[model samples]
Target: MEIDPSEVQSLYRTLAGAVVPRPIAWVSTRSEDGVDNLAPYSFFNVVSVAPPVVMFAPVDGQDGLKDTPANIRETDEFVVNVVTEPLAEAMNQTSATLPHGESEFDHAGLDRAESTTVDAPRVAKTPVAFECSLYEMIDIGASTMVLGEVEWVHVDDSVTTDDKLDVEKIDAVGRLSGSLYATTDDRFSLERPP
Candidate 1:
């Protein structure tokens, strides 16, 4: 079946559903007035690693940019936290829409720790967090892609190995379309052939 981009709203569901197990970026950013906002976006991935850049797309509200993207545009900083099984519920809670200036961390009963390189706080219990400074924002129809350059990284000692992250220990969670979710636990190693 052929679909038209003009009716993005209609085809988005199918597209999102087929993009199985997309990584969750539990993003945290602060508003200009210091209101802390946290939300999860499944449309997130590492776009470049050489200079360490990650991107997440958040669809705009009826008026304009969503709180997270607006805040990032204001503060020029944000933190991307890797969501784990244990924090899944709390991470999901932050996605609820609240009035301007409301704190999702408080709303979700989550703790926050200061970021090393950015003013935005990181999720305290997150196994991995990347403190990023905004590099660019690209608007696509009703959505915007936020590109950030990693300025600093924080990893819980419990989830790290010899200069690498142990995914088994992290047990990161991913979005599987609609209300469904997935875990990294059922993973297999694939060796590259020369």
Candidate 2:
């Protein structure tokens, strides 16, 4: 199907607009006014490894920058929580449009644990969490692309295998176009030849 994005009513609802296998970023940020905001961004990925940088884009809000972007700008810190199958529903709950000064952690009934390297708190249920400091933020069209330098990483002992993290054990979830979600249950692997 050859469909132009400009012709579509909403880009996000169209199948061809959002690429599949999009990673889920359960971002946690604290507003300058001391409000904790948590939200999931499917437009997220690891951009670099040498300095351990990750990028997530938060679409522009009608009022301006969203809570997460504004919070990161003010505090210069955030946490990226890995959303596993068990925590999928809780993560979705955080995506709701709640009033200011309200915390999604409490609303979602998720435990908030302190981060070692950043002020932002991590989700206790996530298999992995990356504590990051703001590296850069760029305004791209209708979205704000945020780059974060990972300062500390926390991995659950259960998900670690043979000194490496196991994808199957983590059971991570991914976001698809619309309201669809996917799991890592269907697996395949390939190794490059020497």
Candidate 3:
């Protein structure tokens, strides 16, 4: 089926549907007033590893500068929390469009922990969180891709295997199209060719 960019509804659905099991970045930021903001973005991934950079794209509504992007613009920092199956419902609660300066952490009954580096607070329950500083932003059509340098990483030892975090232990959740979600439980590994 040919996709028409003009039909934004179909475009959003089709594009998101085609990209199955996209990893979600549970981004937490702080407003200039010091209010906390938390939201989930499925359009996120590690774009670079040399300097450790990650990105999340927020699509603009008819009104621009949603809470997350607006807060990042003012503070230049955010924490990307890894969402696990246990935290899925709470994470989904945070995706609500609240009033400016409203705290999603409070709304979702999630505890906030102070970050060692950035001023932004991290999800206290998340097994993994990345403290990030705004590296760059790229404009693409109506969405803006926000890149951040991973200044610090917080990982639970319970999820660590040797030097890496075990996927089964972390049990991270992924976003599919519409209200569908997935977990890391269904996974297999194949050795890479050297």
TM-score of each: 0.95, 0.93, 0.95
* Tens digits of per-residue lDDT for model 3, 1-194: 66667766547878799898999999999888989999999999999999999999999767887889889988999999999999999999999988777899999999999999999999999999999999998889889899999999999898999979887788999999999999989778899999
**lDDT agreement with native, every candidate:** 0.93, 0.90, 0.93
lDDT of 3: 0.93
1-194: candidate 2 lDDT, tens digit per residue: 78787888766656423588788999999887777789999999999999999999989999999899999999999999999989999999999999878999999998889899888888988889999999999999889999999999999889988979977788889988777889989999999999
Model 2's TM-score against the true structure: 0.93
Winner by TM-score? 1
**Every model: Cα RMSD to truth:** 1.4, 1.6, 1.5
lDDT of 1 by residue, 47-104 (tens): 9999999999998999999899999999999999999999999988998989999999
In terms of lDDT, the poorest run of 10 residues in model 2 is 9-18
Q: Return the candidate ranking by TM-score, descending.
A: 1, 3, 2
